[model samples]
Target: MSDEEYKKVFSKNLLHFLEINGKNQADLCKYIGVSSATVSDWCNGKKMPRMDKIQSICNWLHIEKSDLLESQSADSASYYLNEDARDMAQFLFENPEYKVLFDASRKVKPEDIQFVKEMIDRMSNQNG
Candidate 1:
């Protein structure tokens, strides 16, 4: 992504993380030792934090700086997963019901073999 795109994504992610962490702008300002206005600018995406402030913000939010920035290094799992494994992992991770389906398939039904085969086929087709 372009730098501007990355910045926008980072800003949105930061705002979401802060909100989830129960931090308001005033709390973030105090935690990062920045002016309330500066925190406001960041929350609104009016300005990007400086490197030092970014580090401080990451520390305050209990996230790594790379994760806040959405840097490639922050997503090691994605990097390691091959195309097929990535697709399978994404599908299974999103559907908790599939875990039961998979476990039950292994213990008793020959139909479970067909179900897994169908899942792999569907993923391959979607990717193609």
Candidate 2:
């Protein structure tokens, strides 16, 4: 990636993991022995850290370097069986109101999964 693109990707990933792990810029600064301003620059996409510092942050966050460096394809359907499954998963994560679908699905039979989908489709059709 170009330098600007690298900054944006790294900063986005850094902020994502920091929030996931309940960490803030101050916590990162103390751990990496950098000033708060330096951490802020990294978090805000103003600058990129050196390789050693990237390794340090990875160790601190218990994540692989690729997790910090690479942008996972949010627009692609490579991992899932299809695009709809991926879109549904993203929707479920972004909207906690539908969390019961997830909670209930865990105990549901594999054969019943399609039934639930059909039920949803029927309900949506009725509403539409």
Candidate 3:
């Protein structure tokens, strides 16, 4: 691989995300409608994906382009949040109305927002 492609391939965030989400090369091929050789090339760092396919992959993964571009220093970086955070994310995902309310609260006073954040933090720390 060229140095630039090397950077893209070895970051390993895609592999990390795939594993955490219980997928493999075959699964990824199915999801992205690519061949096994293409997926293998990606997994083995033999090639970098084209920019066109990058968007397709990101859209399929529900991720932004930046997630695929972590540096080599982050080869072992985590892609998924912890279980508690995942639970909270799923809660927000399943409750659009609640998410709307939360989003709307952005207009609330900063001090009021801080107080609510602190309350959640204290409760979470106690339970955690």
Candidate 4:
């Protein structure tokens, strides 16, 4: 790919991962030891990170270098119903601790799930 194309793909992937991971440019800037301006440039597709910095970012994000540098395929997984579901799957994959709740929900009835959610919301509201 050309430099511009590469930048576009990388920036898109970076932004998607950051958002799903509940992170921002500032978090990336601190973790990768880059300036806010540099992170902003990368996110805006104005520039690309060097190979070493790319490696650092991949390590920090717990993803592969190809995940950052290459375009992801739409049929990456066949199970998800749509893009949002796939994004949620990716989030669960990255954070396995939360996956247990998702897995448990699969075995629950709709009413039971709603009841549990309401209970949790009530508990949270009380605590807050």
Candidate 5:
């Protein structure tokens, strides 16, 4: 997806998830250890969260990062499918057919890894 499309999706999803959880920007700021302004930026799609903050968000929201990215809502079956992808990757560590692929793909470039991690965080928060 284009960066703008991704941003819009992320922002919408985050707002929805927070609303479902009875949260607001102030609450999220406290939970994620960021300023309310920062949360607002994220919610408004004015800015995105950094990679380090993604884990804190996941922890605060009690969700897998991947679930936030691929599905629009935490309640969707597609959310679980995203989780399943991670599980499958872990499972593939022991599966002969995928072991080589897993090993080779493990070496992700730093920038790509950060981008993906951020996307997952953004997606999950959006769905929340």
Candidate 6:
């Protein structure tokens, strides 16, 4: 990819990660011991973080490095759910009523299994 496209994608991934985790530039700066301007540079695609710093941020967020670097990582992300999601998915598969939902979703693409699991869990909570 061109450098321009790469920068744009990098910033997009950074922004997406922050948004999903309910974090802001200030929070990231404080947590990662970076200046607001540095974070701003990252968010604006003007620069990328150092490898060590990127790893530190990933560790702090309890996420894989790919989560912040890859586009649409959520779509293909597997076994990356938190403990609660893991438990909820398991509970749903074991509950007969919810089992029907999973069986019906057998046609869902493998990449979308995580999305289906979340939706079904939400439905189960509502019905419970």
| Among all candidates shown, the one with the greatest lDDT | 2
Q: Report the poorest 10 consecutive residues by lDDT, candidate 4.
A: 99-108
* Candidate lDDT values, in order: 0.64, 0.75, 0.61, 0.73, 0.61, 0.70
Q: List the residue pairs that clash in candidate 1.
A: none
For residue 124, model 4's alpha carbon misses the true position, in angstroms, by: 8.0
Total backbone clashes of candidate 6, pairs 3 or more residues apart or in separate chains? 0
Show model 2 residue runs off by greater than 4 Å. Answer: 75-128
Candidate with more favorable, higher TM-score: 1 or 4: 4
Collision pairs in model 4? none
**Tens digits of lDDT, candidate 2, 28-114:** 999999999999999999999999999999988777799889896777323334455545645656866454455432223434544
**Which sequence of candidate numbers ranks them by TM-score, best first?**
4, 2, 6, 5, 3, 1
lDDT for each residue of candidate 5 in 1-128, tens digit (9 for 90 to 100): 87766667767777766754456889888878788888888888777787667667766655666544444655555322245454544554455444333432322343443455467568768999
**Deviation (Å) of 90 in candidate 2:** 12
Q: For model 6, where is the 10-residue window of minimal lDDT?
A: 101-110
TM-score of each: 0.51, 0.59, 0.52, 0.62, 0.53, 0.57
Candidate 4 residue-wise lDDT, 40-114, digit = tens: 999999999999999988777666788788888885632333555455555556766444435432223445444
Candidate 4: list runs displaced more than 4 Å. 77-128
How would you encode candidate 3's per-residue C-alpha lDDT over 15-119 as one tens digit per residue?
A: 865654556889889888899998887877767788887778777666667777654354453333344444444554575533432432212444443455567
Model 3 misplacement above 4 A? 1-11, 72-128
What clash count does candidate 3 reach? Answer: 0
Q: Model 5's lDDT to the true fold?
A: 0.61
Tens-place lDDT digits, model 1, residues 1-128: 87676777777878776764557888887787889888877777677888998888877666677767774445454421245544544465577545433332112334444468588668768999
- Lowest lDDT 10-mer window, candidate 5? 99-108
Best by TM-score: 4
Query: What TM-score does structure 4 among the candidates reach?
Result: 0.62
